[model samples]
Target: MFQNSSFFQNFSTLGKEDTPKSQWIVEDTIANWWRPNFDPPRTLGKEDTPKSQWIVEDTIANWWRPNFDPPRYPYIPAHVTKPKEQTKLFLVQLPDKAYFAVPKNFKLVAAPLFELFDNSNGYGPLIASLPQNLSRFNFLYNPP
Candidate 1:
């Protein structure tokens, strides 16, 4: 529909010709736009760092998988050994948003779970009591 329009005719050859050149326009390979060396190398004519001054670095490949041929990390032993102690902690939440590491096969009853244990947070490193009749309550640690 816009074929006969005079507005389209004036701009018809926009990208058809070769780019107009100028000595001031810097090539991307020679100069990065973000660097201090971007603007014609600060009136020196030659670049700040010459081609002969540049170092050719051949970095060593240090990539190794967990169970691979090139052994950098320690190998996993065939047979795994068990710990001497038979203690396992059960994580529980208290009424006042404090965590209690309860032992496995622990009796979750009243006196020992709440009454027997001291309410103060100084008796021992371990804390107690999963709140009575626990409903929907969110208490999780997330980094800000």
Candidate 2:
């Protein structure tokens, strides 16, 4: 519940004949968050760019915005600007070698730490490895 002051009373007049909506409009607004009525500035070619780089318009992904159909949800989020964008790229290079191998003691060291398991039916114990049997290795060896 809101306080019964002038602040809450003004909200009742919003979009009504009593209040003017022009006061809410901001100059040169770009909606990068999520909205249907909003037309944000197009940059970097969203249609041509890879999905991994940016979020593209999709059915389930754009569920809150609702495209050529009625809105499935009743509520929507508010859009806000941060004045600046931040992008960070990480690239790791591996040493030049013929083949990669896991240490003999890796299983013993990783057993007590963590394990991957599938719990589709119910909760179970830790598994040795996943179906794909994938593992990550950090090569930080220095040779003299």
Candidate 3:
């Protein structure tokens, strides 16, 4: 199936350019805040621990703590966080392929199809339950 397909080659090459810079940015940010060298050396006394260590911890704790005020946005709620809602999904299988659909209020969390169906041989009643256009379905996982 492999060919000298420039389309595939070019498509793959498109993402390579930003990969190294993105990796470096992530590495630098992590290194700046949590570098191993910034850690207290085994030989060093308690007082010898880098001030950076405390600063990083304080930053993290402040971020997580509700009362810890974030910089200038005083009026904004400090404890504001998104609440996750339970999701329900349906799995519809055709003779050749499978479809995973989520209801309007729910989100789709992609996972292996084999987890729900017996893929050992083939889709059995699962295929028959699906409509001809592959729309009718049943719940894959029920949320509590």
Give the per-residue lDDT of model 2 (tens digit) for 23-139.
Answer: 422211112221222223345657752211222221111112223232222223345122121111112232343222222322212222232345312211112222222234333
Assess candidate 1 and give its TM-score to the true structure. 0.14
Q: Which pairs clash in model 3?
A: none
Error of 2 at 82 (Å): 1.8
In candidate 3, what are the lDDT values of residues 53-134, reduced to their tens digit?
2211111100111233322221224464531221111221222322322223333333244432433223222222223212
In model 1, the worst 10-residue window by lDDT is 10-19
Better of 2 and 3 by TM-score: 3
Q: After superposition, how far is residue 88 of candidate 1 from its true place, in Å?
A: 1.0
Candidate RMSDs in order: 31.2, 22.1, 24.2
Q: If scored against the real structure, what TM-score would every candidate get?
A: 0.14, 0.13, 0.14
Evaluated at residue 19, the lDDT of candidate 3 is 16
Error of 1 at 53 (Å): 68
